[model samples]
Target: MLSAQHINKSFSGVQVLHDVHFSLLAGEVHALLGENGAGKSTLLKTLFGMYRPDSGTLSVAGTPVVLGSPKDAQAQGIAMIHQELALIPELSVAQNVLLGNEGRELLNYGRMQARVRPFLEQVGLNVHPATPVKRLTIAQQQMVEIARAVARQARIIIMDEPTSSLTTHEIGQLYRVVRDLTARGVGIIYVSHHFDEIEELADRVTVLRDGRYIGTVRQRDVTQDQLVTMMVGRELVAQTAPPERTPGAVRLDVRGLSSNVFREVSLQVRAGEVVTLAGLIGAGRTEVLRAIYGADPSTGGEVRLEGVLMSRRTPADMMGRGVGFIAEDRRHQGIVPDARVSVNMMLTSWAKGKVGVGERDMLRAVEPQIQQLGIRPANPHQIIRRLSGGNQQKVILGRWLSAGCDLLLIDEPTRGIDVASKADIYALIDDLARSGVAVLMVSSELPEVLRLSDRILVMREGRLAGELARADASEERILALATGVHTHAKDPAVA
Candidate 1:
């Protein structure tokens, strides 16, 4: 349905794509796999007409074409769904679905909803067309995006990390939608860091490494280990059980913490310990973290830092008391998109009354951390928004590391990060714990929780259902706790 040959793209004189070639056949799901800065986004943008290659030829249905904008691509039966959602929050679902294509005609709410309802149904989104988009969950919003693409009659669609924020059940729904689209002869170019998704959905997998095409292979023909080797030219060591440590005095103590989403959550993280909150989506893990950091209002609770009651639990108060928070929503809550890497990294320091530090001094101070975290482009002056998701996450971690906080509250630390970057983050967290920085984290990925946590606390229905030490923690046990299924054996650790 679409093809690009000899594609080369550069940004600010730095080449990002080199003689890259990609093709999509009708009714097939072609997956594009890569690490954070491996040119995946650039290639997708090129295909979707958000970017023009320096040297390349794009052909649609055997005819050469030049796409000057996304409109041109849409006219040529191509659409893209970005990882960060693009729908207007206040707009109705129908309005967003038929946004540009609504024509210059007079507004007709009834007609608009009627026309957009079929597309919504086609994507299995059950909400009323007139419903406000912000009221829908992330999964529903994604379906709305797909509904819009389907409404455009797009023959080719690019989905970037569509399941990054979805739960297991929601992911299954997405798979069904993809299959339905493919059955209707719609071609898809899927991008994700999750190998299991690619293995399930992709007919063929093409890999890019450091802006260069590595190779393409049939999904069933290659192991994940082989793909990892292609991605990083490495056989990464599997994460093993962390060594046992005797944690120091309690650093963060939450007693009967209650919020709108959760109730009476009590937990303690000792100095030098890594305590992970494990749960399904909407289990209030994020709210708990936010409440602890004073980002969310707590109806009741006492948060103590090293036995001192924190009567005023504001963000500045927590930061002043040697606490740092890494938010789950990196795009909105965690980063200053317009700021330079140095500025974003030094935000905490500046907030703590280091306002006299000049830009040069800030850059010099954060340079070591930037290098240590392996932030790509390696330029402190670079705008952080231009970096990949994994690199952006690294900068956020660098922010806290530079702040030299004693306690860290991290939520989904590696949510959208690639594998190599995830390992880097894991090592960094381990290092922090070893250095006596108390770590409290929330993670939905079972493997990550198992790999990193000194202790796992499972939350179900916004409450702590049980707790498991590192030795007793397993995927099955954690799920049992999370899903509220009683284990046959009476385990003392479970509460």
Candidate 2:
């Protein structure tokens, strides 16, 4: 029902999309596959009226159209669910569902709930209409987002990484919802990092690379490896490496860690060792790391660094104790997007008295590190927001490494980043380990855990399910632990 012809878009003199042509038909789920910065999001935004394409023709159902604003797009039956969900935490499901264009004179609570009830049921959500959204899990919150779209009666829905943070079971539920939407003649634009999902949910796939269209193919005609080759224009390097260990004394220790979202969990990491925390989403993996780093409050836990006991404290206190934290949400929690590269690079150091007294000295301190980290467009004054997502993450990591923390607690080191940059990030982390730093990484990608970690720890339902040596952990083993599978047969190709 939606179509675009010869679309073109740019940002700050850089061409992000060029001669991009795309279309969607009723009841077809079209998968858009690409690396980060491939203009996938830009194309979606242009169609959704967030940006006016410099030159292109858009049509809906054979008639040319202009979507000058979000309202205009919505009026045209187009809806987009952003990668970052837009639900207001304090609002109830009913309130959020009826947010835009709430009915007449008085806002009718009973009518609002009644209006939302069927949509919730249609999406298979068991949430109460009156329940606050903040209390719901990520999967439930995502359902609320989908329900909102359904309530709007959108004909074309764009879902960006919809299953990135969802569990296997939750993904199945979402797939059913998508299938149901398609059955009712709705079209879907699916974007994701996982290619397997594309095979499962998509009718056709289009690949984009470096802001240009590579090609499109029928799902049944191509394999996953072929899709990757088209999207990247290269064979994916075999990413298997036997885990190495030269571990030393304990670097970080936690005893009886308790938080509002997590229970009394304890863990440890040693110097020169990479410990990975693996679990299904909402298994309290991120919470455990955050609590130890003092980003979130821990009700009852004694955190120790190098045998020194740390009391209940804040992030600053944790940093002062030789601990570093790389939060999962880099956009919101990690870096100042609008600031210059040098400023972001010096953020952690300036806080720790590493920046020099004079302006010249401080500039000197920032320049070398930025260059060493290979931050692209290496101009120190370049705004970080202008850089690619992977480059932004590198600057953030450069800031942390400059601060010289002995212990690093990182969350989702590769989420939403490109594959080439993922390799660089792995190298950086490996170098940190060679320097005798203890690294505790939490990732959802099974291959990453197998490739980079010296040891792996699995969590289930807010508890430590089990721990395995790198030699012993396989994708199957980690999956079994994460998904509650029991198997006696061991896979030799663990790495």
The local distance difference test score of model 1 is 0.91
lDDT tens digits, residues 1-495, model 2? Answer: 988888888766667788987889899999998876677888888889988998989999999999898888888888888778989999898888767856751267788888789999999999889999999988999999889888889999999888767878899999999999999999999998777788889998888887788888898999888887887788887666645769899999888888888787888899998999998887899999988887888888788888888886788988887788998988799889888878888888887897764668767877888778776656777777766667778888888887889999899998877666677788888889878999999999988888899989899888887888887888888877776767677543222
Which pairs clash (backbone N, Cα, C closer than 3 Å) in model 2?
none
Give the Cα error of residue 204 in candidate 1, in Å. 0.7
* Candidate 1 C-alpha lDDT tens digits along 142-242: 99999999989999999999999999999999999999999999999999999999989999999998888888898899999999999988899987867
What shift in Å separates residue 249 of candidate 1 from its native position after superposition? 1.0
Note the clash tally of each candidate: 0, 0
